[model samples]
Target: MITINNEPTAYTPIFLGTTQHSLRLSLEILIMVGMKLNDEIIETYNVSVSAIELGQLPDIGSEIAIDEITGSELSGFKAKLKQSDAKIQNTASTELEKLVDLKNVGRYQLLKGQKNMTQELNVPTLTNDNLILMRQMLGVTQKELSVTMGINEKTIRRIENKEQGISERFVNKLLAVYPELAQIIEVQFDWVSLTFPDLTSKQVIDDVLRLQDNLFLERPTSQNFYTREMAFAGEKNIYIQDFAPFKNPETQAIEQKFGTTLYLTGKGTRLFEKALLEQSMNWRNFFEKARQYRGHLTRLDIAINDKWGLLNMNDLVKAVQEKRFWSKSKSYAVHGN
Candidate 1:
């Protein structure tokens, strides 16, 4: 089960830390501490200027006495702020850590949401309840999933009703059709040491279903959405399809990592399939993008083009940072079954 809390009292950190304390010790603090400090100073300056207009001496505070901050001090704040990634990450990480059973991508979302975490994945441990939930989420009936898996609807029903444990064969089939489900249904990180939250009531279910409409089919894009298509000759049908498959290695890696992180589950794959339809993947442009994403998909120890495998945290971050980064589809569906 997922949980979230209310907003924080203030955006600023209540307690001082080693680096912040060090920064405070610098002459920069004489004028302002950070954004919060700058905001306070600016507000006071505005109010003081108003008093001056009426011929009154503004006794703002003691900081104005000895420091008598100049505009130059404020200018230096930008440079310091530029180097604040560590502090920003530390604060966000601290809050996100409260939620367990999250991969980096899930953690990133929780941070993005709370300053919050969210999503589950595909794994053997999934309950039969999760099976029904996911089937319904994709807008597919038990018959669809059954047919897609080369099985019968009765088996799907039995699994959903908790008549059996989710077998490895079933898990493999589900992931093959929806690879991204793995991360969303299971905790794949070391920091995720806590067990699942206990069921609050009989009405409350344990599995996360079509979480946030992952199962909901998307509305087809505008009529003119597909501006390009090529005709193909089949046995009896003339097939014209939009968007070519993106087979470039680097781009695929980047898309896999970025999509895995952003969409947080199968919903991500559905979105990418959309980009393939509307977003331009013009060969020359896509080739360059593939190169850029490849650079970030590897590390000093591993050359990307020479190695193709699962990415780690640093590589995932770089892939998501790509300017041309794509997203999940607003509306999508499963059809192969």
Candidate 2:
């Protein structure tokens, strides 16, 4: 049933197919029709929602012949037209409400999905000091980090300055913005590969050993083909190759293309954990040196083994399927059950 001037109007064939599934699509059609009818109806009349709500419909006022609207027939025609107009208004209002509700639902779902994605990714006893350190290591100012992390600059400042204690919500938001931080959160590196186009192997080795007064690692040992290799106790090792392998034309061409002149690689996590644990290796200084030497970072890997089972891949997939998340990937695929 539909209301018309406080009276109920039943569904009829005349109103069938008048409503559209998509209110926005219907609005587009109405706009197009209004544009086309501009010449015919422009400046002739104006109607608005307020007018409709106020029941301030325009007067018919001698527009129709007196004979055409006479007695009971005229009254019936007037009632029917009023009923149709009221039904249209009600339908439009309902559809508009639906559109607003849909928008709110989408917003809620997206936030919920994001929460689910980061709820378990705790930063393991995060503190104001570490937060400051992370920001400094990333080489971003507080304002720049706030913009990138989607957090307020004032909040970041408060947290870093010890005015506010670190909260789980803040850490979750931080990790959501920078999941890579999990790997390097504690200033640890799992694997690092650097190529120096200008510096010799000896120069690179000397710089590494001199970083912390050679207190961590033993002296370098000669390796087959490779110039030198240094190792801390355990499985951590740094391998250096003074020259690129140009065994064949193909290898030489590959080296030329990639520019692997003097390759240096530090592999395994124990190297940092044992050897450089107490060392103050300024990453900014290292980056500046690399830039000075025109070195290339061929490979760098960061990963966190979720031994505590913090990550949920299933929820991530669900978020993607529900279109409740944003991504840079052109496309995503779901394999297996």
Candidate 3:
């Protein structure tokens, strides 16, 4: 029995050594024992208490103490709990690493496949704005257009809004349904025109050649010179006076062909003279050379010479300067000069 504040209570011995006793009293007795032990140490005493005896005492302390064996067991249990917690944390970390590796591998494979597909198939994509514009231009509602194109209306709407990507088959279907609309939605090229004045005969010829090439013309010919029959149509008794006197038969034939008959009008004469002066060539000298070449020249020879000679040079220069020579409405075969 132990006295707690002068009341008797049962007690239990925690450790019993030879000639020694260690007691762990109940909380109520522990408090009273603490007060008594505070003043003096006591001799060894045997004590015992049953569980039923402990129930009769009033509850006083928050904590209960087990025997020494149980206390030692609790410490070992806490150590095992820490080890288990560590093992669980390590397992979670390993699983996380594996998951990350798998995700990265999947992403790499997907990217590789996409690259190969892009190279294998030459597919073109259209933007949302272009898709919408094309649909509007074709005057088709989403549902009707989708039905005609053999695609889902929701897919069409998604493509138009850029919410979803379009497939090559869908693009082809749209093109087939609205051929003109495809052209309207395509990227366009801009054309620019340039103007110049006072270009030389050579320059005009070069420009015309360039234009012909651009327009995809096969064969281009100048309209300056004419053939024998073409030059002297109504003339009669065309006889050459002296072959040596004229440098070219073509020139001679042309002179004989015209022979002062093809009189130039006042306006035509002024235009021709202006053209020659602008080209910085002597018109008189040109005619003299033509007369010299005309002696025994063939029609083709004369035509070629005249073109390369002064007439074309002067005319081309004038046409560029005045804008009057090459009008579409003006005919090349005038009766006069």
Candidate 4:
């Protein structure tokens, strides 16, 4: 039961299925069908436990940053996931709790088709940790259990270590010591769901292009003469004004296609790479997208240039001193202005 707006709502009826079955004969039939369905659910469908958990995961909110989330932000994030987890756990717990009531109804409807309680025997398959947990729950030390079972403490430890799978006699001895363990130890697989930030292709492209545009627009330039580097690319030391821009064959030919090259110094490249790496996303996914976006942005920014500044030395200075995209490709060449 849960309270809603100051009203208490009961949750009992939902747990007990609509029609309670009776008779060992009817149960055997139902079990057969249930087993068939379980196989189809697992083998025919690709659905996995992890995927189911992920589907039920609560929204973590975009306010959670890539850098840090502390105090209330962290608390609220965890509370949402835990609330969902509790809902899942309750459904499983309620189903198990209804087992005895269903069994009673079945026996009554069948007119004592199965009468009287019989001892239930199960395999002794408890793990190392589960043995310790049962001992802890009984509030007994290993030494005490050892004496009660008439076994050495070292033997108990070895069995818990999985050196022994436990004999029929050993399980009987354990039940005598802590009988509740028969009902307490249930094996359930726990699934963990992970959440990642939402990032779009447009956002990634914009960020990469913005970095290039800043460098392009503010690049240090040579006014009247070619910088020592630009001349190597194929700049003739002719008068800057004597040629009316396109009068130079090389200038006209190059302008018709692509703009003059923009040289990205090692420094600017380093700064951009660092920022791209720090983005809050999977590193492999980020770099894969970054590499593609960087290529597109490079073409757009450098494909066109002002005639006067066709040869841009480029803005890529980190203060008065000083980078990897180029080094990774190693495509640097000494070219003309």
Task: List per-prediction Cα lDDT, in the order shown.
Answer: 0.28, 0.40, 0.30, 0.29
| TM values, all candidates | 0.22, 0.28, 0.22, 0.20
Model 1 regions lying over 4 Å from their true place = 1-124, 185-337
Output the TM-score of candidate 4. Answer: 0.20
lDDT for each residue of candidate 2 in 177-260, tens digit (9 for 90 to 100):
876554331112345667765654555655542322221233344443443333321112444445432446655453311222
Most lDDT-accurate candidate? 2
Ranked candidates, highest lDDT first = 2, 3, 4, 1
Lowest lDDT block of 10, candidate 1: 15-24
As a whole number from 0 to 100, the lDDT of residue 86 in candidate 4 is 33
lDDT of 3: 0.30
Clashing pairs in 2: none
- Per-residue lDDT tens digits for candidate 4, residues 10-91, read 3111100111122111211111000012111111101112111222211111111111111232332111112433333312
The TM-score between candidate 2 and the true structure equals 0.28
lDDT of candidate 1 over 1-337, digit per residue (tens) = 0010222222221111011111111222211121123222111111011111112111112112111212333443211121222122212222112112111223111101121223342213457766676676678988888888887788898888888677768777777776545433121211110111221111011121112121122222222233222211110011111222345685654221111001112222222222222233322232354344331221111112101122354565555555335545344333342
* Candidate 3 weakest ten by summed lDDT: 15-24
Best by TM-score: 2
Instruction: Give candidate 3 regions above 4 Å deviation.
Output: 1-125, 181-337
